[model samples]
Target: MPETAVADTATGVPLKELAARHGLASSGRLLGPVEYARQLWGYRHFITAHAKAKTVSTLGTTNLGTLWQVLTPAINALVYYIIFGVIIGTGANTTNFVPYLCIGVFVFGFTQATVSQGVNSITGNLGLIRALHFPRASLPLSAALVEIRNFITAMGVLLIIVLITGEPVNLQWLLILPAMVLQAMFNMGMAMGGARLGSKMRDIKQLIPFIMRFWMYASAVLYPVTRFTDHLHGWKLHLVEANPMLVFVELYRHSLMENVTLAGSPRLLWTEAVIWAVVVCGAGFLYFWRGEKGYGRG
Candidate 1:
């Protein structure tokens, strides 16, 4: 019998002959495990490269650039301690308000960094985005990575404070790792969303600082949420209970404080956190992806 050949529909070439001539018999459309793995590896490499280049470029601008990440948060913590702890007399009620405020500010710093820096991630990288055709998500991811690096540095400062204050470190402290991961996931989503929104509406850039300030006051960073639950009733109480930052702060206090749990309502707060994480992340990713091509233009 003679050998049979299949014709290529688009080019009108014999498929088998083309395959034999070009040594491409096994190089069909990428629909299987090998192709998937190859693409995944390529994406991973691209993301890592983008993150590294961004980190270096961002930190190289100043002589004490990297140190400033740690130093800035430490200074902010001191300011908060002086105003809220020493001057305002809030610390007078708590046994160790220093560590309490330290953790609160440090965690909140992650959120603050995300909102403030994220607004400019797309605009700031307009040159690079227009010049390169890589994934737009990489920009926000790179920014988030830089923020996480700063968070870790601030965390080191927090640990030093914890030790100096004679606080005990235990296995529960490990819980913070997952909490931080969750927090980062939440921030990444928000950053991506913020980047997309800010790119479209420049007014959003101006509003972020005010929003963050209001968020700080509402999140129980300065005072415990419990202080409000005692005075409010019904819907107002529900509003306070539904704040995602309240849950996050409670989680931090629970992990750091000796015996603190979700003070008012554990179930309600956890549900809010889980819902916010899912909804914000999902919506943010979709919003960012939809506008991926537009980011490079303006």
Candidate 2:
């Protein structure tokens, strides 16, 4: 039997050879890291639009609309204040307990929501993935962006609370900008990692809430970070201080509140913040990239 080669009709060249000559790749093949990044960057507009759409639709059904973005965390902070600050008397020794807890609650809540949404980013968008050829990373990045947009509104409420609680407006408040940037980077990384895991294991989404709850306590959201100093020492103390969420929460406190002292020096906290942001974000991106080809496969 004679085999007939498949050829591009217009060029009259064999299709496989024509594709090779044009530097084409298999549709399902994984792209090189550099190429993948470039492709993802090229889709930035789509990502931003997707994020904005999701952010708007998130609270569209509610009476308050986007106001719930600020209220949700504000209410969480109020509840924690009643339970931990008043009933438990955890805030008795700390100054400016109200703003302190608000910063912790809002910041941790942002990260928790970012990661939780990231976990569903892929599974939630299977239809889009199957129908489109855009970078899959866009889904997770858009998930992070949605939270970032929500967090900005929440921050406005947080600053108002800080002012009402007697924290003076100072130049250090500007530090919140860089602190937020670092936290956003760290969060993007967490979301990418979660997206990858979620694509493979549906159960991971169900577990995220429990994990984030534990992370909230570990992050010192309802209590003073200084408590770690009283109970632990050496590597134990150092390890707890290195928790990325705690580092971010303390960074917010250091910037906004003058009365609160942190578990570590400002220099150490900033260093850890930069390190965690780079390390986690870089590692998570690579981890997710490695699974790129498998993302939409059933």
Using TM-score as the measure, which candidate wins?
2
Off by over 4 Å in 1: 1-41, 264-271
Question: What TM-score does prediction 1 earn?
Answer: 0.82
Q: Relative to the unseen true structure, what is the C-alpha lDDT of residue 88 in candidate 1, on a scale of 0 to 100?
A: 88
Index of the highest-lDDT prediction: 2
lDDT of 2 by residue, 1-298 (tens): 9999999889899998988998997887888888999999999999999998897787888888988988899999999999999999888889989999999999999999999999999999998998988889999999999999999999999999999999999899999999999999999999999999999999999999999999999999999877888899999988888899999999999999996889788999999999999999998899999998888888
Off by over 4 Å in 2: 1-23
In the range 107-193, model 1's lDDT, one tens digit per residue, is 888888877878788888888887875666777766777788788887887778877886788887776776777778788889889
Model 2 pairs whose backbones collide: none
CA error at residue 203 for candidate 2, angstroms: 0.6
TM-score of each: 0.82, 0.93
Evaluate residue 66 in candidate 2 and report its C-alpha lDDT on the 0 to 100 scale: 89
